[model samples]
Target chain A: MKARVHITLKNGVLDPQGRAIANALHSLGFDKVGDVRQGKFIEIDLKESDKAKAKSEVDQMCAKLLANTVIENYSVDLVE
Target chain B: MKSAIVVFPGSNREKDAEAALTEITGTPPVMVWHRDTELPKVDLVLVPGGFSYGDYLRCGAIAAHSPILREVKARADQGMAVLGICNGFQIITEAGLLPGVLQQNAGLKFVCRNVNLRVETSQSLFTSRYEKGQVLSIPVAHHEGNYYADEKTLDELESRDQVAFRYCAPDGSLDPSHNPNGSQRAIAGVFNRTKNVLGLMPHPENAIRELLGSTDGRGLFKAMAEALAA
Candidate 1:
């Protein structure tokens, strides 16, 4: 099984990295960008075969180490 | 006085913290590795700075889960003195020993400069020298030091005198002109409910020596020594 975790800063929290990316994009001539929020996309290979169990385990992983709940939120998707 | 300085693989400031302790106590501190499960009995614990575990995922997040922190937490809960400096502050937050969170600098830049800090409360074991509103020049070097918390929590911290330190301008008044990280309400350092545990974004260890251009940070250590000796 495999899992993907999408971690992003929660809304209303200032995202400096996102702001820097937006600035770079604007300077690169892509002015259509109104706002940009950069986030982490992590893929992990797991030995667990149960999709349900994998989702829960990955959620725990995100909560424990992958994301800071105070400033960011994380979700996990599992695939066989 | 026996003190132990926790050392993770990437903790470059461990020696500096130890040196500061040895200079004051006239004895070197025990350097506890992150993998250790037990902490030797000590009067103080210093979680110094550096990119622990490469700052993976988030700053201080990985190191917070390190094995030794379990012991640190247990002792801290018993009213032990704990000081988390710079990246160590991130660990303290991630470990749930303190309120609020430290995020990326609002300027999106790694700030490295001497900043003026106000001693909001000198009643703690960590900061007992400065009078309330007294300003001290200390250096701040960090990327994720923008402190954030909900309004209710901020109100609670303020009402409890837990707001220990604030960044100030040269004239000794709050100003955003030099709020390096854009920390909420210009907060630079804060204390837990009991005030035994302190987590601050600025590096007081860096300011302890005379060659660093200021000895304003020595009072923090001296105060701790006096508290422990009492």
Candidate 2:
């Protein structure tokens, strides 16, 4: 099984990197961009054959290491 | 006072912290490696600054989960004095020993320079040598030092007098212009609920000597030695 996790800054958290990206896009004449936010994507390979078990384990990994719950949120997708 | 300095693989400030503590306490501090599971008996634990684990994943994230941090957390919970400087501050916060997360700087650039800090309280072991409202010049070097927390937590920290220091002008006034990293309410440092643990973004260890351009950082180490000796 393979697990994919997406970690994003929580709503209302200040993201300077996202803001800078937005500004650079604006300078490049992409005027439609609005309020960009940045995040992290992590992929993991798990030997667990059970989908339920892999999901639970990946969830724990996100909670403990992948995401800082105070300022970021994480979601996991499992594929077998 | 007997002290220990936690050394992470990428930590660059342990030597400075060791020198500061040794000068003030008249004894060298134990340098505990990150993988150590047990800490020798010591009155204080100092977490120095640097790009621990190369700031991979997040600042201080990997180092926070290192083996020795478990021991540090255990000792801190038992009322041992813990001081986290710069990256150390991020580590303790990431380990849940302190509230709030240190995000990237608002300017999105690494800031490395001297800044003025106003002592917010003189009641804690970390700031006992300085008077409330006194200004001290300290150097801060970090890319992620902007502190953030929920409003309720911030209010609680304020109500309990947990704010130990705040960025300020040389004359001791709070303003966004003086805040180098855009920390909430200009907080440069804070104390844990029990006041035994302190985490701050400035490198007081680097400012311990007059030749270093300022002797302001000596007060923090002196305060720790005095309070722990009592």
Interface root-mean-square deviation, candidate 1: 1.1
lDDT per residue as tens, model 2, A1-80: 88999999999999999999999999999999999999999999999999998898899899999999999999898877
RMSD of 2: 0.8
lDDT of 2 by residue, B1-230 (tens): 89999998899999999999998878899999999999999999999999899989999999999999999999999999999999999999999999999999999889999999999999998898999999999999998999999999999999999999999998999989999999999998999999999999999999988888889999988888889993
Of candidate 2 chain A, the 10-residue stretch with the lowest lDDT total is A71-80
State each model's TM-score restricted to chain B: 0.97, 0.98
TM values, all candidates = 0.96, 0.99
Whole-model alpha-carbon lDDT for candidate 1: 0.88
TM-score of chain A of each: 0.93, 0.97
What tens-digit string does per-residue lDDT give for candidate 1 at A1-80? Answer: 98988998889888878888889999999999978898999999999998888888998898888888887888888877
Model 2 segments more than 4 A misplaced: none
